[model samples]
Target: MKNLNCKNCGGPMLIDPSGTTANCPFCGSKYVLDHRDTDYYRDFYERMRGFLHLSADGQERRRRADELWDSAASEVFECSDGRQIDIRSMHTYKNRIMTAYTARQNIIFRFDIGNEDKADRYRKNVSSIDYPSADTRSLSDFFPRISGGFELADATTLLVVKKREDEYPLRLFGTLSGRHTAWLIGRMENLCCVLEYNSIVHPEFGLDTLYIDPYDHQASLYGGWWSAVPNNTAVNGRICTTRDNLTALRETAAKVLGFESASAARETEDVPKPFADFLRSTPLSNAYEDFAYWDDVLIKSYGERRFINMETDDKQIYGKGQ
Candidate 1:
């Protein structure tokens, strides 16, 4: 079976004899796997067990076969220069200025006619982000990386940005547990810190513009760059600052926890008082201060940092059973 970790402490967890429960050896935290989780882990273990029995050449062939299956659902488009481009996409998002397709390794944004300037700005804003020297994290990978720009035969502009294979839109998860959303909040705070460092204000920094890899507990900002502007820029007569990013982050966490807004978030069995209070509290003056404030709240709410894995497939999340 897959190795499970404690959600309350970063300790190794041992599966109970029942095969549907696990407990931490170090912290004594216990977890009962739901039906879906149990099934997922059982199937995963069987597949991995079978894979391990195969020879090296057999494993390599399986890897290539899986890659081919992933790219099997693709569409071919003609470029202005008579070159054909194949894009493997499973989801599409449409806004006023552009339509974005979630491809296998890239997000393809096709701008509407006469929106070339907005497309250019989208690329420029992401490219201009400068991280602080103290930042040892490879933060750039979490942001957009414009890999290709093309002119299609239909007269629309196409912009492609790299995306990690594990990353998926935050919307795909629907509602999550409080502890899970807390980690997402922490990730969003980290992203806001990067934006604050670059003096960039992303107006739409919520679920629609965010992506997450649940296995790694990593969040990425991959959309809405066209609306990004310098911090303190006037937007609809209101001055925008890094605080806006933090506020949006709270709202995002609230939404993921099944709340309409941060102000409406309240303490429940799953959500602790400190976590709810953080959601409803006013953000500090800047991202740095707000992040520091969040760290304190996190400790008060959860005691210590832990890595929790919420595993499932599309069937579990959006199947007829759901």
Candidate 2:
């Protein structure tokens, strides 16, 4: 038996090795075990936290995140702006390495560094879809939306830059004492929200090549483009990616890519409508609800893409004339 806390009540509970259900003693709530994976537990706990309106715990989460940033900044690389660029993030993925470094100041400087091999792979995969002419020009030509020109330094590292405002086409967000970092983070989260949406709508998307260019608040996911800039919420303000525009974009892309959905997936299951719903119902204080809501969106977006892809492949095999 393993001791764990109840997701709903946060009270103590014990799990039997032979049993599948976890019953909460205090709340009398029962949750079925799902694979018992670490990620499943994380999600389970997060969902419970959200259900309990546990934003108060966010302060601790924020503190831990601050510590991570501080640790990342412990060893600094000086930048042109007299501020330091630290390794804000870096990790290895199979044969590839992905890293993000930042200098938070009046003008933020963020550099996304990856392995040349990985960059080349991405370049090859996305170029044809992005470039109608099949032009294999420079990296900038390949991902034109990325203002930060590619820096192919040595045989190892490939760097792409993006910022709030690109003085040099690719830079970092910096305005009034790191205010843009929040926006940059928000931009990244928004892209994840979209990717989560895509993962549900198309399971194969896998978010493997999900790229968010904060410079323009846009994203590229498995060759599809997405607008991820957050909408203002003034009393009479409007939301980004209105239902009409999203439907148009989806239909246009589907037609261009020859995605003939015999039975089109429900539009409400995607991010646009549900996100809009979140914006309407969720108060400013419960901003954390947005992440939980988007997670649900991502889960729902899966499998739908797999079916569409299969149908598209069938069309390719049978013949476009048919």
Candidate 3:
């Protein structure tokens, strides 16, 4: 009620009225309420108002967001090394909701290592590897250098933008509805990297994709087609790949280059007008431009024959050397 710090990790804490518990958003820990404090409920209620924009449109958007969250699967998922992880909803906000409303469709994953004893060590790893600490291979150097505004959010959340010039930095929304959340959980195991998971479902051509560094191309420089819509598909282009994360790196790549398809692949009919308005308000840049910029930079440094993952001729063949 006092905006007190989290007892477990000392991060900011918020009160959850439904559960009668105080929660730490930074570290998914909960604590019992001190019911003796009669003012606690009133204080929390006041605090929650700021968290929720209670205007008519805000209430409607909140309702829709709650529906999206309620629909999210509650089963816990196991990571690569078998750590049990759960998907928790932290906060939601509709950028600029208009008429017909749809759930926010982007998700920015910021992973936290939960080993209490190893907290310091995890921070070290995240700062040294996830951040660009003299490591050219760090995401900061890799994504921003390559193209697009693959900017790091809080040194961990990778805000995936179509072009480096897009002024509005897109936050990853948890609106993919199902398997994507599980995919993100598995991918974050033992890895301190940010990821952007998105799905554009429209009447014409829907798209689902996520972006991260190449699995084996650890040289610090980084990184799809479209399948027909499935029968009764809520979204189009159910692209698949070798990676279990369900990310469309192998397909639907218009976000990182200056290619024509990238421009053609707009979300006009697919998403709600509010999100489209939010996107339009920003200095929209195509993902191809970002890809092309990185391509040129990598080419200049690694030479004409450098192994770029996006190129057909330069593609990595898994077990085979590039």
Error of 2 at 50 (Å): 6.9
The superposed Cα distance between candidate 2 and the true structure at residue 259, in angstroms, equals: 27
Q: Write the per-residue lDDT of candidate 3 for residues 114-205, one digit (tens) a residue.
A: 22222232233223323323552444532322111121222222221121210111112212211121122223211212221121111111
lDDT tens readout by residue for model 2, 1-322: 1245778878655332123445564677877667764344444333222211212354654453354335333334454444443444311111114433332211122223434455454444333332113342222322323323243332233334333211111111111011112222333344334433322122112112233332233433322122222223222364432232223323322221212321242233122343333223322222234444434643443312121121122224223231
The sequence of per-residue lDDT tens digits that candidate 1 reaches over residues 198-243 is: 8989998986689886556789999999999998999999999888
**Per-candidate RMSD, Å:** 13.5, 20.4, 21.5
- Top-down TM-score ranking: 1, 2, 3
For candidate 1, give the lDDT of residue 251. 87
What C-alpha lDDT values do all the predictions have? 0.76, 0.31, 0.29
Model 1 bad stretches (over 4 Å): 1-73, 307-322
Error of 2 at 310 (Å): 34
Better of 2 and 3 by TM-score: 2
- Please give the lDDT score at residue 162 for candidate 3: 27
In lDDT terms, how accurate is model 1? 0.76
Candidate 3 lDDT: 0.29
